[model samples]
Target: MRSASPAAPKQLSLPRLPVPELGQTLNRYLKSLEPFILEDERHGGLAFQTALNLRKKWADEFATGVGKLCQDRLLALDRASPNNWLEDNFWTNKTYFEWRVPLLVNSNWWLALGDDEHVPLRARENMTDLTPWQVRRAAWLVHRVLSFKHLMDRQELYPETTRTGISLRDSVAKMFNTARIPKPRCDIHSKPPSPTVFNAETQKIYIMVHGWCYAIPVYEPTSPPRLLDVQEIETRMRSAVVDAQKRLASGASAVQIGALTADGRDKWAENLEYLLELSPQNQKTHRTICQSLIGVSLDGPSPTFASVGQRALTSHLHAIRSTHSNIANRIFDKPFTLIVDPSTRAGVSGEHSPCDALVPSMIADWALAEGIELAQFKDKEPAPFPASPPQQENWERLDWVVDEKIKSECVDAMARAKAIIDDSDANVFWFKDYGTDWIKDALKQSPDAYIQMVLQLAYYRTSGEFTATYETALTRMFKRGRTETIRTFTTESRAWVLAMLQTRRNLLHHAIHKHSSLTREATTGRGIDRHLLGLRLMLRPLNGEEAALFDDPLFSRSQEWKLSTSALSAGSLFSGTGFGASYEDGYGINYLAAPDMIKFGIESKSACPYTSTDRLKVAIFDALAELKSLCLATDGAAISQSQRAEISSHL
Candidate 1:
């Protein structure tokens, strides 16, 4: 009897991402090009009318010619894809895999967790020995994170929905037990055996200490396995720390194989292959890391800085790109790595290929909210021994077989990583001024759009020019959707900047409204950038037969992304979040606009003489203050004295 396999359990259904009409996308693309044409110096100087007409001609030809073919191909792809067209066809390979640079500071995103108040700053300074608080905090975090994973496994965690009750795509399945594996020309992501089930092997996590890697189980053996309690996890961690210390005291040196992960993709691929060939033990160890749930680094104390913002910056930097001394204490390929220092100062650095930072940050928000209570150990000794002696054999140290070739490669990789760390100029700026509440109530503006305007003003004031800018817009409303670009540098925005320069307030509101409209379009899957990208990828290998619109100089210039910016949720549980700049001569700005204040994480390269994080920080402050004054002055008598005084105090 053929039993029609009970119709596959009705899966949570969401609409597929729609491919915007060709004409609509083309029209939007031409409008976006206007800002670039206005500043074009090509052909000795492009006259406004002449350049606009030429661009229009190109757009007309593209809309009817090769562009139509590309659009048709894209539609065909959408029909064939099970979920999202961009994701199934070319998103990851085009956006992430083909980019061969080291992921250390260039591609990975980092988030610094809010401080654990139980462990104060003074207690962390110049700390040499491992404290009980450190182990306990690490254990508690691990337990909480595993609990989040369990909720996900059981589907007990409700699906995240939009304000209108539309379900956002689920990416949490990829956030754990995944790794981005590097290959010759393109990298691939490794998948877990079962995303919804946990076994003894799948329940393990790897820990790195003093440039050494060790694996420990996080689930107890039972008829139905249960997560190890905090005390039990702490026992295992303490045992590993003790073993690492003893090995160091006996003068045993670690090979720093993790350094290979921080090298260029091709180089790392070669080194990894060679190491595996050198010993069967290395192959087993490699599989263990790739299949483990996640990696946690028990790090040493970070160098003390002058301000809390600086301390946050240092903590995030350590998580993303470690110092040369312990550079090998990280596996940057892991989907997420939780880094905790001696004082329980914590942060997460994630590989960007498997999913966006938002996916893991959601998990972090849950884990960070439940801090270990002071009462848990108030009356106990500083260091509590495990009631039962710890099982030392359960911890397996990951050892690598290194020859001269691998050793030399490690040295080169370390040098390259160190250079990047030194060149990064990262700053965490806490804007104590008013935030979303003031923007919505007093200025009557969208907080995100207002911040975009502020960034435009800040960059123009700093560099004396406006360049191509990118703001990420999530398309999670569709099944398996990722992000679409919201091009923030528009004619309206430029006019507003000039108006501000001349103290003319007429165009400010118009510009903000335009940005808000663009943002809405992007979030709804009608953005110009992703559609254009999909069409480009659909093009067949062409020998000078491509669409004229794509070959136009403005097309390439408009996407340079000199100012790459994105805003996360209020982020009350996070100190700051950031990613590297897309261009060497530009800046990367990620911010959190809370109800009462804003926090910004800004990064630039020190080698770029025109870009300075410190200068940008100053400019942001000036722009925000100026905008606040203008808003209040424009609506005089509308702002009450108490509200004015409150805003003044925050500044």
Candidate 2:
């Protein structure tokens, strides 16, 4: 199903992630300080040259002192590590698992799948029966996902490579049958002993319908397991749906055990301990869900919007979080949960600890790439078949026994999740004006760098000051490589923003070029942030003393990440994607630069007085328009001074 051919090399054959040179990291660190120094100069603090000199002095001292010691220890670590020093030592625990927040909107990432052309989006108003199109679509998706897993287990899935033939790390092995298990201080990834090997016992998947959980087998019992056909899976799913409806109609209520996973990590761990202690059946159920191939949530219909743009995309993303009425209908700890609403609108909400979002997104992309009409069941009618009802024994309902205290805690967790959801100001903006095609072909610019400039202009225009910005850069060229931060708010970027405000276009190309250079450095694993992080982490073990370079006030101020952004593949198979803001007053922005349109998913906290998603949207629009005009006017012609002045006035 992958776009690549099967002859690609295996991931284990790739080179190990290397430690950046100590001197190289130090030089880059000093360069990154320029923006902060400039800010201090503008704010009437230290003069620019004096401040730069002071920072350089600190860097030079640290480079020879504690920094050198940390670099030596890091080199030792790199040699000791089998795959990646960062992943083996620091990344998973420090970056994700040790964070105590609930995973719902705070840590999990969501991807909105493009609508199925065969099942058009329709109003869910007063719809009572389950849409056959929805079930069929869900079945088709499940089949494709399992097929992807099959390819992965068989080592047939093509390994991704850079244009220059460098193989990217393959993380598809971690994409299924994995769950983030909560512990006291740090969570752990629970996976099968041989995660990459296909196991018949774990080929079942859990489906949630009407707040009830059902475990249904997805593979036939045989020597070489065969996947169930779409009709078989759909029948099993329909039986679970009908059974759940009947149980609810008869006044049976689930204990809402799933909500426990959405609570704070420590609390969730405590509750899980108590829950397992209550009964062995509960422990078995938990293990079953954890080891399942994947989770599917057959959600009720989503709210309809007037148009299929910002509002519709926003609603769809919000629903995928299972925040309101369906809060208990989700296993948030699952590595990836497939959510399908009525009318077959679907997306994926995934736990962040196992692998990066891009890993699971690859599966989603492949599954959605081919339409249902091309599947084996193409000849079947879109309507539900009148076949005999599924056997009740085919699936088992998972139930939990809970005391009054546990019930009360579930209520508390649900309320906390609701409050967080209510406070989030999130929206999707479809910038249809133009996209990477025009930027690359017409303006001869790197689309990513140009967009980073647009973000700089937008943020400065909205807040009157530039702050730290974060963009994700993949380091998958190495074994077990994950990501490195690309700081987007550089000194050159700041200058370009100022020039844009003054209608001076000379600095535009410089800013974009700098951004592209930084991006290249990050992707090749010469990034400054991760190296500094490694050094800082090594200090306590190497020596008890702290270093002045890391202790400087500007150091913390420069890494606030007020603007957290990332871009995926062109995302023609996805409507949008998003994650929570890194800071309360900041914005979390994810975008897809399609050929002709760019889709943006922006999130901020409404509780933060300094942030407004709508205001930021307007600024983004204005910035894009202005950048287009400026590029067009300056691309190939030399304009007269009066003509330039006229354009500046309009700008």
Candidate 1 segments whose C-alpha is farther than 4 A from its true place: 1-12, 41-44, 120-122, 160-169, 195-199, 304-321, 374-392, 542-544, 635-651
Model 2 ranges off by over 4 Å: 1-12, 120-126, 159-169, 195-201, 303-309, 382-389, 541-543, 635-651
Cα error, candidate 1, residue 417 (Å): 0.3
**Count of backbone collisions within predicted model 1:** 0
RMSD of 1: 6.0
Residues 590-623, candidate 2: write the lDDT tens digits. Answer: 8889899988888999999888988999999988
lDDT of 1 at 443: 76
* C-alpha lDDT (0 to 100) for residue 635 of candidate 2: 42
RMSD in order of candidates: 6.0, 4.5
Q: lDDT value for candidate 1?
A: 0.80
**Pairs in steric clash, model 1:** none
